[model samples]
Target: MLVPLPSPPPPASIRTQVEVPLALPDGSTTTARVVTFNGLVDGLEHLAFGLGRYAERHTAVGSSPATPVRLHSECLTGDVFGSQRCDCGAQLRESIVQLATEGGFLLYLRQEGRGIGLYAKLDTYVLQDVGLDTYEANVALGYAVDQRNYTVAAQMLLALGQPRVAMLTNNPDKVAQLRRLGIDVVTQVPTGLHVSDANVRYLAAKARHGDHTLDLAQLTGAGRARPRAAP
Candidate 1:
């Protein structure tokens, strides 16, 4: 069952766009038409990047070869500072390359720390250091395990004329949430695992607790010791 938004969704429209060339750490470069939206239900400044022939491609609803899309939440530590405590930075980079090749959109959402805000996330890290898993740390701080909402994501997609999409994510909840919000997710694409000594436990916790589609075998076999089983 789905709970409706508090109010009817506000009409959304393209507010602006700019062509920006992106240079990745891997020495690859591609240009994206970055877009901003107006009239989003939540007034946050979420952005969408049009990649790989988005301007020339057919964007009709239910068009063949549904547009590839990745809804990326903001991660300051990983995305900006190159922190390896999580796989966020790697996933974002991979998404750009893949979306660019496939011709799609990347919705950069301003959801930090799973929607708990930056300060709270740092507090959770203290709990995590003392043996709490990610979700447990969030709960210990009196926050929901995950508080991300996709209504805004759906709204952005609808405004962009992409009623249907092929979602790039390992989290099934993202797919389910989008479907419930009137966005047709025709495909669910998984990202490669980014396992490291610093983030092995974090990845395992996501797979065990959040039901993220990650390979435990590969996680443990990535030349790193296996994290203890989740409680």
Candidate 2:
């Protein structure tokens, strides 16, 4: 029997909106609005950035297609401290730079360690050091390989008045989940591989098990590679 999916509840409204100056990597500056939203049910606060009047442009009559959007999950270690254990920091910076010119919104969700939380993520890293892959370590801890849920992301998009988006991501599951949650993902812009010796194996594990679209040879240069810093 076919059962209909229930509609998601109305997304919470923006709690605060403020404009601020943003410096781009290219030595240019632009004004962007930072909007904070609080989840109605979960109470998690998410940040949405309206880059260079992106909200105004998108809300204009006959605006072309959906806006370019990046749904980036928060990674405290990588994003804040520039840890090279994964490509999270690099991807976040890259997204900011690209969105500066492309004019889009970035939803920063607090889904650390793919929704397993920080403590478990650190424990998983220890297991990974002892010869377990990322997914295996999660299962060993009695959690799903990826505990992330995109319902909040979809709701945030709804709140931003962007029902569709050209998503920037390497994970196919993100696109699939957003669509299942009723957001129209018009296109996918791949966040290219940012490989480092500290994260090569980590990225490889994601590609193998997590269905991330990555070209290992291109990333690793076709050999057993030594660790290199992200460019």
- Name the top lDDT candidate: 1
In candidate 2, list every pair of residues with a backbone clash.
197-227
Off by over 4 Å in 1: 1-8, 55-62, 222-231
Tens digit of lDDT per residue, candidate 1, span 55-160?
A: 3334445577778899999999999987888889988988888888878999999999988888998899899999999999999998889988877888888888
lDDT of 2 by residue, 1-231 (tens): 012134564566767877777765447677767888766445688788877447343445224677889989899999888888888987877777777667788889888988889999999999999999888999999888998877777777777777879998889888888887788899998886777778888888888999888876665653233322333
TM-scores across all candidates? 0.91, 0.86
Candidates' RMSD to native: 4.8, 4.6
Error of 2 at 12 (Å): 2.4
